[model samples]
Target: EALDGGPLARLHDGDLVRVDAVAGTLDVLTPGVLERPNVRPDLVANGYGTGRELFAIFRDHVGAAEAGATPFF
Candidate 1:
């Protein structure tokens, strides 16, 4: 939900996506895809409240789902 609610917030239906596992790359193929503004998440709300801060390390370092979404090597 991070990317969907963050950087890729502008993403919508019919947007083309390109993936190259061999080269380890993912791209949004839709034109102007990079031009849109990203949705900014509420930092305080995300990092605080309901004990969410307990997982701060994971929230800070985790990668994309396509990249296995792991924070460690």
Candidate 2:
């Protein structure tokens, strides 16, 4: 009874995925999911702009000062 005509009916809740296309919508794979959530640091260090940007964004926005300073990256 999925309304969107997707393959959700065929999928389990925790399935891994890479969406190749969606009808009448932008075609892009899922960027990051549970099985893979981050670019490796070595890969980032090897001149990937997107990875570097992601790293910088994470470093700048993660964590609060009062919670004992847990590192997010």
Candidate 3:
């Protein structure tokens, strides 16, 4: 699975993370050794142009980021 903000925050720039695709798991070798990367969380909430309202439906209906964020129920 994709390691989002929480797990990513615990890893350093050079740290290694092992992902066992077969087992569907990940292990962070060195955690909390480096700072998290800067992100624009506010921008996500601000919406984009006039299409923002139109796209809200898709956004709300979409699945997880790693799961293609599709509008498939």
Candidate 4:
């Protein structure tokens, strides 16, 4: 699972999860299996490309992709 550190902060690596797309919800089968987020520094984008700076505003302000990718604040 992609650990974004948003709502599923308590989920761990081996924890079982059930996803119900029809109901639009996720159920954690095993509780108390929280794991610390493993954020890799090498995976972080540094915005060092031609014309890449132009979209920096959109990258920083855009809302969730599942929410239509709209700008916010």
Best by lDDT: 1
lDDT of 1 by residue, 1-73 (tens): 4555554676778999888999988788899877787775556756788988899998778887778889894
**Predictions ranked by lDDT, top down?**
1, 4, 3, 2
Lowest summed lDDT across 10 adjacent residues in model 4 is found at 34-43
lDDT (10s digit) by residue, model 2, range 1-73 = 1122233333445655654455534322443332342332333454456567656655545554345434563
| Prediction 2 TM-score vs. true | 0.19
Best by TM-score: 1
- TM for every model, in the order presented, reads 0.46, 0.19, 0.39, 0.42
Runs of candidate 2 exceeding 4 Å displacement: 1-6, 20-73
Give lDDT for model 3: 0.63
Please, what are the lDDT tens digits per residue for candidate 4 over residues 1-73? 2335454655657889999999988888785544445553343566658888887888667776578768763
**Cα lDDT for residue 44, candidate 1:** 74
Query: Pairs clashing in candidate 4?
Result: none
Clashing pairs in 2: none
C-alpha local distance difference test of each model:
0.76, 0.42, 0.63, 0.65
TM-score of 1: 0.46
The clash number for model 2 is 0
Query: How does candidate 4 fare on TM-score?
Result: 0.42
